[model samples]
Target: MILHRVAKENYNLLYSIGLTGYGVGMVLVPLFAEFLRQAYGWRGGLLIISALMANIIPVGMAIKFESHKNSRQRNGFQSVPSSPQGCNEGTESNSSTSQDTKGDSSDEIGVVRTIANSLRQSDFYMDPVFNVVFGVTFAYNMVWSGWHSFLVPHALQRGISVRNTIIITFAAAIGNTFSRVAAGFLTNSLVKPVTLFLFATILNIAAILCDVYFDNYYAMLVTTCISAMSIGGRSVLNQLVVRDRASPEKFDVAYAVDQLSVGFGLFLGGYLCGMIADHFSSYDATFKLLACIDVIVLLLIVLVRYRPKSNPA
Candidate 1:
């Protein structure tokens, strides 16, 4: 909702910064968890986290919704007034008050009607652009969930030590942080978001291929960073695509629907990847299959029309 208030050119930048925070959290949380465990044990750590969660309520309350009319007023663009007819001052004042009341009531009715219409509309599900974005988002989430669930186990199986695995994870988080910020700038300055999304998908496919084929510790570490960079920009890109494809009034609904698809993908991806590994007796085969799915995601991205309201900055 806050993002909907921002200009289109800056959306990716803001979204990327948000992703960078997530990357930072991924790196920081493990270190913090280890410290808390050492200092006060797991029960104390859980209590601390529970207490911290309460802060979110106040933070959420601080976010104020700015209406479009208020935004225009702040910009000094007031509504034009009609010419006054030859009437007594008392009659004019009464007429103005009645008009204001009618206007307010009509606005309320219009809002309710739009919501009712949206509830009955199947056009959103049938839209070609929506279908493409939905498919790509689902695929991306599935791949991401699978990688997160299996990457550590896969590394351990390949004979990497616990310390080196942690180092690799740290390296990936660093790559993810930088890449998300860079992706935002790149999307605004160099390429259409859809084009950037396609490139990200390609990077993911390459990273998965490398993970499957490489046995060397350094090589696997590089693949890990590549995969992280690829995953970092995905959520931001998903937001950009949905905003571009849907009307401003429908953005919240569209995003909610997209998130639902993503949740399903995450569940299916994690389960299916584990099943594949069990059947093949290796993570390598599972990654190879993921790479194939990424190819399909890339193709879907290619089909999505990049019709933004404004040109790239």
Candidate 2:
């Protein structure tokens, strides 16, 4: 249970480092798409983009997929009960990989088995910790997807110049990339991912409120940057939080489920954004709604964290 937290290499940091590439792509993709749209009409741009994307088929086929048996053998342990009491001695028989890097050495050797015993048996969603991760993922994706889609429109409505809107987008991309790298560098044993998630969500809501209640081009730029940084932290912590709770073997599956939640949130978020705005007759109504959701989701996570465990029957 503990090694998951104190892994020698710090997987979260590595993961955050990798995600910076995605942030870079965020800035680059728009420029590329715009260029394509201009160089060739929209239809031609789509066709070219489609042709370029088809390369993924060959790339996917070229990668050698690992067998499940090999994967289990490599991981060497399953993640069992997450009682915080640590894994039982019965699991002590499983010899885990020796963890050590130049300056790192964790005394705990029993990297407990995964959250789910096997691929077919995934009771992980029932775990309160996983549920907390789920809620955080869902709300973060829903609100952020809406932000990505509507922030430009919202800024234009506030009379921000198109040139300045582009600046805001650049600012956001910079903030997102910088924050992710910062999170990677800053996170350590004492820093908890859930705590980071909470603070990030708070920052996100605060920025949204600032942008909604007040209107100034500079203010929008600053708040958008703040929100982007908040999102960057959430993006980094998303994997870390789940990493803390899931064992090595189950990490792949747990992460897959987390991603599925993100997809669901994206769909629902766009829908809810439109629906709430139409229902409330205010374009900014959805920001307020998502802010409230942020509060509710935060409260639920707090409750889950503190809820007394039912005495094991």
Winning model by TM-score: 1
Candidate 2 lDDT, 92-124, residue by residue in tens: 544333322422333222222342344334435
Clashing pairs in 1: none
Candidate 2 lDDT at 125 equals: 38
Those runs of model 1 whose alpha carbons end farther than 4 Å from true positions after fitting are 6-9, 67-127, 305-313
lDDT of 2 at 51: 97
Candidate 2 Cα outliers beyond 4 Å, as residue runs: 1-8, 33-126, 188-190, 304-313
Looking at model 2, residue 70 earns an lDDT score of 71
CA shift at 29, candidate 1, in angstroms?
A: 1.1
The per-candidate count of clashes, in order, stands at 0, 5
Could you give candidate 1's per-residue lDDT for residues 29-85 as a string of tens digits? Answer: 888888988898999987887788789899878877678798778757798987767
lDDT of candidates 1 onward, in order: 0.82, 0.74
